[model samples]
Target chain A: MTGPRETLVGITDVVKHFAGGGNVLKREKRKVHAVNGVTLAIRQGESFCLVGESGCGKSTLARTVIGLNAPTAGTITYRGQRIDDLTPKAMAPYRRRMQMVFQNPYASLNPRMTVQTILEEPIRFHFPRLSRAEVKAKVEEVMLSVGNDPHWGSRYPHEFSGGQRQRISIARALMVDPEFVVADEPISALDVSIQAQVLNVMMDARDQRDLTYLFITHDLSVVEHFGSRVGVMYLGTVCELAETKALFANPRHPYTQILLAAIPRLDASGFRHTRLAGEVPTAMDLPSGCVFHPRCPHANARCKAEIPALKDQPDGTAIACHGIEEGRI
Target chain B: MALLDVSNLNVEFPTRHGTLHALRDVSFTLDKGERLGIVGESGAGKSLAAFAIINLLSKPGRISGGTITFEGQDLTAMDTDALRSIRGNRISMIFQDPMMTLNPVLTIGTQMVETLQAHRRISHAEAKRIAIAKLREVTIPSPEERFDSYPHELSGGMRQRVVIAIALLTDPSIIIADEPTTALDVTIQAEIMALMLDLCETHDVGLILITHDLGVVSEVTQRVNVMYAGRVIETGSTRDIIDAPKHPYTRGLIAALPQQNEAAQRLNQIPGSMPSLDGIPPGCAFNPRCPHVGERCRREIPALRALGEQQVACHSAEEVAALAGNGGSAS
Candidate 1:
């Protein structure tokens, strides 16, 4: 599973920080470290999932990879090409190869636009010379592939159900024939039953289109089923990265172990959870050393003083924890 | 007698076009200190069923026909003043979004004290003392400091804990939580749920947990009601229902879970979405999406019949049970 593969996207020590309240007169300044020194490579044809709680900067990382948000430091390479610093006009070609699917279908799709118009806008923008009939054919093809009725393409987005609206969103993403997609919590807004339908559509699209996915979500169950490789993030840093099966079966980091243990499994009878001491700290005011040390039961004096770099273990998992490296936990 | 007993409950929203039956024939019972979970998709009337029990339905929505009996007293027939005494004092409710449920303008202590004083004739200082204890009971760090904070000062998970504390302030016998943890993160949800379970057990409180997560239902509740299209399609022990679900809809829901299947496999999705309240199909409301639909299922409504320890509202319950035994596949 860890065999050599073509790296589609390489993120090297990427950092995205947003400046907080500070006036010209006031010398005091604050910065929200949304993504802090994260490094990872997304292999081609793999479903790479970034799992974290809210405000952990998983969304910010996804946006940074797609060039939606510029990194404050480090570099982002796309297929052996440095594309992060490219201007909008220079990055236009990469844009066609990469796309994004947002979480909320209710807000992602324009209520005023018909599904036909929504799907065709991307095709028309990418291929302006195509005939109207050709563009319509592409729209219908994508819609049918997503298990939506092409005839319903004329209907407004508000007319469709949540599941159908998500299908439309997927169809729009596929309109440009993108090879890679960054789906930010795509199915979180849908119901459990509807989540399966949308996930099936996404898997089908991946297989049919040979598309690599940067899947970001907080749901561990979905990640176990959908992700090929998983990255566990905490406070804007990649705490652990490993194959999905390895990560689920033998989580390395303390936070990863706690996160996996906290999931309510159907096979389990009673409620049992890993008891962490404190809540997730605010991103604006990060802790001194290991960001997760405050709540980590395995944290020691060393863990509280110095941040551990993500080190590769014998099992091929990169874990950022001194306790794991020292065999303390 | 059970702490809470709802029978033949029907909730409707009368519109200009027609009366939308949001909940029909929804019935369940909660024993003392027992937790009952209502699992369903959105628009399935799980929340409406819980709302109707407390007579907290918004305008245009009314309990057209039903009996919600609590401790041998009919809640639906009670007068406003009488119901008011029972609403917060005897049966407290928790909504999904704690931020919306809590009063943003008021401090935590003020709100909890208000709730305590509204139900019991206690002095302000006594109410404040009780409120502080409840806050501490929910495990909010530094209860004294947090009591002065408003809703915006707390995080999503802490706000939910505050909401739970408020619900438990009156020492209510029954707590109807409608997706209480849905708005929080998964880890936070686990902690909050564990806290609720521990508190409920310690205090011998009956809980009516309404959620869409089957995993949470299987872990928390002793008994479960699986709802579909405004109807209680299946009701049984959580163990029995999760292990060998009798209804096609229930089986579909369990199979639809991503954990039930292998990685990258097509999930066993129930074909179509649930019907809107007004457009629910005749006969069996789930006949359209049900895998085991028959001619009788299409022509007549099935009554909830007892099969072993489970109550199933399916014309093909026996066949479905047999099918489940032979490896139930939702595809």
Candidate 2:
């Protein structure tokens, strides 16, 4: 179900480009367009998923939104306040309100710190006036909420399994009582059974805390079950954005259709994927006009000459495809 | 006879503390041109089972028992040179990470030609010609141009295709692929899997696909083996196992998948993580996590018993079947 209707975070034409191949002597520089002109709105108390394959800039866009990386252009507004360009002191409060859960559980957690210390660090950092006993109580409470053993707080991250470590990661994110959590491929490293467990914990947390999540992942199946609104990204652009049900039922964009078809379903066998020609072009050397036109089956002369802006359809989906605009595909 | 037959396989790692049974009583058969899938979580010995078949298990790990027979010859009894001859010539293996499989230092052409010359008495030019043809077979664009390119020059999907080409170059009767598409993107995974399926069909090659993805297993393999904690807990047709699983673990695995239930609901997760090899439970390795665990399940192991088209190693197989039927109806 859709959560509260209020918009929590608004991203407008965010462009994040990284400098590449630059040296002091020659001064030859190249710009790698990681996130190019993307606009999205994340509603309160909803699981907004950014789905894309590798090199699609979904992770970079997420990092930029969470203030981990600065955007080269465009505005990111949180609760009607421009937070993207805020200074460190100005962004400190938002940092506590918005936490990030990284992809690799093995590398994300500090190997030297105990689970207790890791969980308490955020709470203590956010609330410096809180007593040590208060922080410990909060840590234990969050641990129990995530279905972890409270006593295991003394254990290091390396002592726990992948699933347990992920639970700890979730616990750490929930320590500050954040309103928004940007989780980038959190459970992609875990096993399938463990993935379900972690997902259940996240869903339970979402309902209990009334939190909004910006979930980023390459796994489409997880998005189908967990995401409320899905944003399909291709080559640093949001190709399509729609409600999960509508998108899965009637995908308007050709890239979205190809992605959904590529998912291997348990109900059927053999190849059901609509094969697309060509490969994803390098981000360093982007294609002209539409980035996806090289692999899209219905690309025409116009599609290769002009970029297609994401336009709203009657079905409540925002799609970026010249073919869809012209009813060619 | 089946192209590959493994019975009562037991792989162990000898440690200072004790012997760790990495794989216990793993048994399956891959017929000529048939595709078999082994599905399990990590530490379930699915990959180790595949490795042991080719005697490719790393040092400190050895097959303590069981027999792996390929074309009426016992692979377990073969020496190093004999195993080497059978490995790439008759039975090739594809690993999960193509980057790790392909030698980074060597060019694609050199690597392919090396594999060919290792198995066959062929000249460099002939081997190069065959390598290019195999590359073209895998649908690599401009095989001639890619021949001189290094592994680093290829994308993840292209590298996997190159690995597949290397596997097919020898025309091996059986190809054991362990999580072949796990490292690639979903679109690339679909294409690679389709290519593998097509190549296997055209060449009449037997395939033993070891993966944890139930969806991939259903689409690619005709028969499936559900493994848990180094044991094959269930064996049946892919259709039967997916549509009507008889083991509680099998049901739990299928139910744990996100597609099994409605959107945004709590997926039916199996309670605990899989036990390590040395710390497996005494009776049923999955008894601690199994919902339908009985007293007998904790005290004694259940042998694999035939139930129509399926074979399940669970004392409560009948109950599980009834529950699965009720689940299907309720859903």
Model 2 lDDT tens row, B234-301 = 99999999999999988988888888877888998989999998789988888999988999999999
Candidate 2 lDDT by residue in tens digits, A1-329: 54359889999999999998456688878789999999999998889999999999999999999999999999999998999989999999999999999999999999999999999999988999999899989998999999999999789999999999988999999999999999999999999999989999999999999989999999998999999999999999999999999999998898999999999989889975788797778888888999999998898899889999999998888999999888878
Per-chain TM-score of chain B, candidate 1? 0.98
> Candidate 2: deviation at residue A61, Å?
0.6
Candidate 2's DockQ is 0.84
DockQ of each: 0.81, 0.84
**How big is the RMSD of model 1?**
1.5
The whole-model lDDT of each prediction reads 0.91, 0.93
TM-score of chain A of 2: 0.97
Highest lDDT among the candidates is held by which one? 2
Which candidate has the top score in DockQ?
2
